[model samples]
Target: MSVNPFPEMDSVSTAEPEPSPFDPIPRGEPVPDWEEARIVWKSTWNIHVYGFATIFLLFTIFSTYRFLKLYSFKAARMSNGYQLKLGLYIAICLFSLLRSLVLFTDAYNSWNIFPPILAKVLWSLAYPCLIGAFTVLLAVLLATTNACHRGKSLASSYKHGIGMGCCLLGYTALVVTADWAVMYSQRSIFLLVLCQVIFIAWGTIVMIGYASIACKITRDLSRTPLNVDRGLLRSFARLLCVCSVIGGICILMKFYAAVSTFSSRSESEDSPQPWRWLAFETTQRAIECSMCLLLILITGRADRKREILVVPKIMCNGITIISGLESGTVLKDIRLKDKQIIH
Candidate 1:
């Protein structure tokens, strides 16, 4: 009677059910071939990579052109300040190129076209390059300021610049080593947080330096000679302020990312969403390139022949005398009157 009531249930097989399409492969089955498996699992091409590559390439080209044009100018080669500025521009170009390569490597790694190790290596290299470029920029700013305000040549600041550059390089090396060690050996979240915190502090200091430089320029503009374009100086001061603010925002974003990662318990949560991270990265790059371009323009205009008058005081005195003579032959008349009075 019980069998009759549950005939359909009894008829159902007790053997393991067939695997559904969404189900994982059964343990008894042979593993799929790598090529076949990859074909099935491969992700779509990363559009962010293409966008980043294009932006960076364009920036690199423009920067290179500007650098070449500036370098070709006789004045640029002759002036220590101009040379320092050229160095900064070249460093920016290199940074952009390296960033593009790093992005490409990362995209290739994600597509399985290149090994993940290549991406890691490129990232490490790119990070150092970034630090170096930043250091060069800072040194240029300091040297330029000293040259303008204190009448000190870039050559005089060489010792200080070298010391600062070495310190930054050493710090970057330590951070890179710690990052790799933590990634490979310990994988400690605390260590990661500490590294991020240290980086944040360093970045903050750099931004503060930028802000201070901006303020100094603004304060000194009133005392700057009329020969220097006041408008250009003001624009440069404003640009520096903008850079400092933007840099601060970037630091805050990095801090937020670190906090979010620390709070997240799962790997998925810890990892930034692709589109969001891509947008952040793109925005950051765009701002950086734009700032560099603006810097080039401002400096170029400032370096124009008429913007800064380097005429000697002797030339100025001669010119003043010539102008006085042109107004009237007063000196000759005075000499004739003196001769008549003596007779």
Candidate 2:
């Protein structure tokens, strides 16, 4: 038997192309309402769970850095900026780890007919971390200000700082209150929107404060190189701004999509919005990781002697050289007048 000259190739070319895995499937029959709900719920939960994973990875890197620093630095317990910063970072890492475990369990157990009570408990535990992060952010902003440690009489500055800090705290509280209200409304979309607004506003205010402080430092120490890595500082600032804006946008988009779905009672089983949440979560975590990395660069090899008490340029017109000194290393008794310096 002879083979046909034109085999199945001709027919295949005329026939409609078979749908590939990558090809989009056209909507056909409507899915059951209950099945659709389950699908949406699972998809949303998956996104939320993936957010935890991203957070965990960021904190893991930070924790690893902290562990190494604690090991390498002999004076880790000293009451210095390094120690304080390390403590804050470590605490954040621990909090993230705990949250990760809770969210992971929530994802796994969400398959139950009814939501698990344990998941609610786990979420409540995360509330503290949220508050703590905001608090630390405010502190960081204050630290960047000249009022933190400045002038012949910093009493005034201290009072001002306290007042400003309280204001920030109040703002954070309002945000938290809004979050609870939205969440209670059973509107996940609104909750996400509220969270995004709070975080973005916080980040923006902090960044502006930081830039102002950095500028003051530069202007005062114009003669000295300042030794600060300008590139690094700029990178950190840009990262903060970009992450805040991007995160806000992503969250808002997801919130709107969810609202639309709920309002229209759309029966579309497959939801792509969850993927958007995953992306936002990933970006936020990446920013956290970058922050840890920047901190490591600043404090990893801190020189004790070099840790000069930053004074206003006017207070010490003379260049102060800071060098590493072993513990118990004492400087010769040189009579120097006490002068106040702003950060």
- Per candidate, the number of residue pairs that clash is 0, 1
lDDT of 1: 0.54
Total clashes in model 2, counting residue pairs 3 or more apart in sequence or in different chains: 1
lDDT for 19 (candidate 2): 55
**TM-score versus the correct structure, for each prediction:** 0.63, 0.47
Q: Please, what are the lDDT tens digits per residue for candidate 2 over residues 1-343? A: 9887988887888899775544323121112243454575676545656765666666667666665656576664452333334444554665566656755654433444323333433443443444344335334333322233334422233332454446545655654554444334433345545554555565455445445444544454444334433454444445445434443443354355445445444554454444454455455545544444444443333333433322222233344332222232232111121121221
Q: lDDT (CA) for every model shown? A: 0.54, 0.44
Model 2 TM-score?
0.47
Worst 10 residues of 2 by lDDT: 331-340
Which window of ten consecutive residues has the lowest lDDT sum in model 1?
318-327
**How many clashes would you count in candidate 1?**
0
* Candidate 1, 1-343: lDDT as tens digits: 3447766775586556775544322111012243443454344224556676777777678778877877777744554355555655676677678767766655424444544334444544554444445545555565445423334444355543566557656766665555454444434445556657766887787778778767766766665544445675577778778877776776687677566555554433434444455456566666656555555554454345423312111121222111010112342454456567679
